[model samples]
Each structure stands twice: as structure tokens, then as C-alpha cells.
Target: MKLKCVAIDDEPLALELVAKFISQTAFLELVSTFENAIEALSFLNQEEVHLVFLDIQMPDLSGMELARILDGKQGKFKPRIIFTTAYNHFAIEGYKVEALDYLLKPFSYEEFFKSATKAFQFFEEKENHLSANIASPSEYIFLKVEYQLIKILLKDIQVIEAYKDYVKVHLQGKTSPILSLTSLKNMEEMLPNDRFMRVHRSFIIGLDHIDAVVRNTVHIGDTVITVSENYKESFMDFLNKWIA
Candidate 1:
């Protein structure tokens, strides 16, 4: 995937050079160029930019200030920053904000390419890791309860119930359910659909652990869970496969 990029530098010549370098690069797509950091920030807020070539020192708003603001932002709009400046004094400050790379002023195309390659590889590795997680379903998952990450086997999970802001994981042979600080939706995603099904908005149950299904309710170890109207059809489909 191409890294959608934007160059922000107060110097007209510097901006033009960066824009030219971006145009020449195959993996980097130059979205727009801005001589003002404020305008760049506005554009970044509205668009999905993957990487940014930002100058550290500017008039109204500095690159460091902009980087900090972007860092504080939550969600997917957080773009990886690459500090481009003539001064070497800001190198320490640039890395403090977790910038991808620091490029000094009057950098040659070789230097620019090297920095851009770092961004490219960073994004490439990230995409591969996400793809791997989606393609390969794990047999177990980890849950954070308090300070520790507790490993829970998928087959051992009997029921997952939504409790306030947390989800209670009821495991087989366990007297008490493990309470985790996460939504039921997140729990659903972590579980394999073929083995676990959401019979209600508040509950996900393991199919193998179920004892019986009576009408709209599911029985597992004397605990009855009512199947919500929204999920009853899918639950019925699962039951029909075993009816013979």
C-alpha cells in the first residue's frame, strides 16, 4: 500500500524539494504541500494521512507542537511523523515525540530515500502483522485482569457474560469467573466463530460445552442463558446441524 504523505515546511524551497522527492518515490504518494503548519494540521485532521514530513521550527505552530497534538489524538488518524529540519538541536526533541526519522536540512535524495524507506518498512510490517492476526485464529487468548495477563484456553471457556464495563469469563472446572476490563464485542472477536457463538448481546457460549437447548434458552452446567431475538435465528441454525 502506498503511504499517503504530506510535506509541511515554512521554507518554500524546502517544501518544493520534499514534494519533488515524494513525487519521484514509488511507494510514497504526495497528497498535498503546505508552507503553514496550521493548514497542514487542518488537512491532516480531515484526511487519512499515513506519514508526514514535518519541519520542527515554524512561526505560528512548531512541528514539535503539532506532533504532540497528533500524538495525543486517539484512534487511527495518528500519522507517523518524520522530522525534517535544518537545525540539529531539535534532534533530541524530535525523537521524544516518537518520530519515525530525523532528516537534517539540505539532505540528498539518498538520505531522503533512506528515511522514506524506514517509514515504508514500518507500515509494511504493521499491515503484515494485522493480516496475520486476522488470517490465523489462535487456540487461546490472553486477558488482563488487574496487573497480570491471564492465559485462557478457548476450549475451556464455557460462557462469557457482559458485566458492566467488564466481561466475566466462565471457564470449565473453575468455581469463579474471571472478570476482564473489556467489552463483550471484543471478546466475541477474539473467539473463533465456529466453536463459540453469541446467543445474546450479553453472552457468548462455547458450543461443545452446551448441555441442551430448550426453545429460546441454552443450558450449560445448570446455568440457563436466554437467546435474544436478534441472535435466535443463528443459534437455531447451529442447533439444526446437529438435529439429524
Candidate 2:
């Protein structure tokens, strides 16, 4: 099924690029484009959209504000948001808003497609409830280790560390970590968001395995991973929900 989408950007070129990219993707259909956030929000109230291509900086209402407004609305349809911004500073803010992904300015079609594909996977999993239940204790993931496909239980994961093009999967009660040829971003997308979170650019720690949060550091076993400024807000948001 084609995902109904909309593009909102003050910049003409950016809006044009998003619209063009949506048109090229077989699974996405560009329903409309809005230069202002108010008009976009008005449209959202009247219609159901599956995905949004939003530019962060705008004249009247910023993309961040629009996302927060949508989040506040109690509804059955909240469009998956992909933020587009020239400044890399807003990345953490995007995460705090639970944005599907963020596209840095001057992004190529390849980058756009990668983020779009992540959105597709998310919606597909949501539509199929069984696949989306990664939080189940019986859930196991097959990872390529050496020449073998090793099945690892989701509940046994302690931490996942990214090393260049590869990732080291550390497990609880296990001395040896599984090494696989995969990007941390790709792995993060597969894991349940409520269970695993990216504290740093290189680290994705299991929430259950975390021993403590001292300032900006997350203590999982003896490893002290610093939660970078970019992700601290979202990580703290997660902590806030369970603190009481």
C-alpha cells in the first residue's frame, strides 16, 4: 500500500526535492506540500497522512512545534515524521519528539531513501502486530557472526557497541560478544524503541541492563557509556516515565 505523505518546508528547493523524492518512491504518494506549519496542521486535522517530510526552521511555526502539537493531539492517526534540517544541532530535539528520522541538509536521494525505507518498515510492522512485538521474552534475532547465523535472545542483550562498519553484541551472562557486519542505526531500527535506546552515537544499551544513570553516563555493568548531548533529552524523557 502506498503511504500517503506530505511535505512542509519554507524553502522552495527543499520542498521541491522532498516532493520529487516522494514521487520517485513507489511506496510513497505526495498528497500535498505546505510552506507553513499552520496550514499543514489544519490539513492534518481534516485528513489522515501516513508520513511527513518536515523542515525544522520555518517562519511562523517551526517543525519542532508542529510535531509537539501533533503529539499533544489525542488521536488514532499520528503521522510518522522525518525532520529535514540544515543544522545538525536539532538532531537530539528531533529524537525527543520521537521523529522517525532526520535528514541533514544537502542529503542525497540515497540518504532520503534510507530514511524513507525505515519509515516503511515501521508502518509495515505496525500494520502486522505479530512482527511489531519484539518485546516478547521469546523474541530472538538472527545475526550473521563469522560464517554462521547465530540466534540471540532479545532479553539476553546487555549492550551493542558500534565499531566502524561492524557492531559488537554484548549479552548478559556471556563472556564473548557476537560481532556482526551491521551499522548501529540499522540495528537500532530493528530493536523495540522502549527496550533499547541509543545513548551515544556508538552505543545502544538495553534499558533492563542499565545499572544507573549518573549525570550523562549510563552504567551498564562495568561499562560507563556517556550519553551525548544529542540524545540526553530523549534518554531522560525515557527515565522520567519510569522514575516514579
Candidate 3:
């Protein structure tokens, strides 16, 4: 299905670049472009735009405010959002709004294409799994380790444990000692409830990766993750399947 897309940025150059990028993509259609947030919100109320390319720093109304207006009960369709900004400072806030991808400004075609492709894939995958209960996806993330920005698949992470300033990421076959910028609280929000459980405040364990769950610990492969008493009640409640 061809996705209906729109770009909203104050800068003409940024809008032009985004429009060019969208025009080249086979599965996307450029619906409209807007410099003001209020106009975009008005259009959103009437049209079925599948994806929106948004800019963060704007006058009068910021992209954050615009997103809030478009979200929840305000609109019938929830378009997947792709945030583009020059400043990297708002990444945490952008993810909090459940933005599919974040594009840093002054982006090269390669960088723009990469984020765009991710947005496309996220839309398609989200469409495919609309009926299935799943984890909050990990398509967007920052890892200070390898310097390669990490966009982990949520289901791939078997266990996550907080280190002093970093987090040890254990996936299906690979385990990474990642220098994480996000606190465990922020990480907790990014993980979906259906596939993950907070055994410990510092430990977010993937349920499918769990080998066993004893009283004191949860086992994922060879790693033994401890369960704190505070989180135990909620964890056990998560384990109860809603069988009809």
C-alpha cells in the first residue's frame, strides 16, 4: 500500500529535501507540506495521512504541542510520526511521543533515506501486526558503544541490565556492553508490556527469552536475573494469560 505522507518544517530547504526524498520513494505519496503547526492539525482532522514528517523547533507551537493535538481522542487516525530536527537534545522527548524515527537536520541523502526507510518499515510492520499483541518496538534508540546508532528489534533483546553508566544488552546470540544515554526509567517506557517484564527496577527481561522463573530469579539462557519484591506482584500479574 502506498503511504500518504506530509512534511511540516519552517525551513524551505528542509521541506524541499523531504519532498524530494518522498517523491523518489515508490511506496510513498507526498500529500502536503506545511510551515505552521495549526494548519497541519487542521488538515489532519480532515485527511487520512498515513505518515507525517515533523520538525521540532518551530514558533508559536512546537512539534511536541502539535503531536499532542493530533494524538489520542483528537483524531480518528494516528499517523506514524517521523521527527526531523537539527538538535539531538529532543530525542528522549521525541521517543516519549512514540515517534517512529528521528532525523537530525543538515542530513545527507543517505541519512535521510535511512530514517525514511525505517519509517516505511515501521508503518508496514505495524500494519501487519495490528491484530497481534506485541512488545513496544525498539526501532529507535541510541547506543554510545560502537558509535553506530542502535535501532534494536524489541523481541531480540533477551535481557537488559543496568551497569554503572551503561546497560548490558543481551540479545538472541549477541550480548553488547552498550553505553546508554537513557536511564532505566526511559528504557522501561520504550519496552512493550506484553513481551517484557520488570523483574528488577534495573532489569527488564524479555518474556519469550525467559528459560525459567524461580522465586528469586528469572533465567534467560545462562544469565540469572534477580526479581525485586516490589516488581514481583506486577510481574506475576503479567504472567497470567487471559484465556477465554
Return whichever of 1 and 2 wins on lDDT. Answer: 1
Quote each prediction's TM-score: 0.57, 0.57, 0.56
Error of 3 at 187 (Å): 15
* Tens digit of per-residue lDDT, candidate 2, span 137-244: 437676655423467788999999998668999999999888886789979988988899998999999999989989889998888999999999999899999796
| Whole-model lDDT, model 3 | 0.76
RMSD of 2: 10.9
In order, the Cα lDDT scores of the candidates are 0.88, 0.86, 0.76
Worst 10 residues of 3 by lDDT: 140-149
Top candidate when judged by lDDT against the true structure = 1
The TM-score of candidate 1 is 0.57
Measured on C-alpha atoms, candidate 1 has an lDDT of 0.88
Ranking by TM-score: 1, 2, 3
Please say which candidate is ahead in TM-score: 1 or 3: 1
Clashes of 2: 0
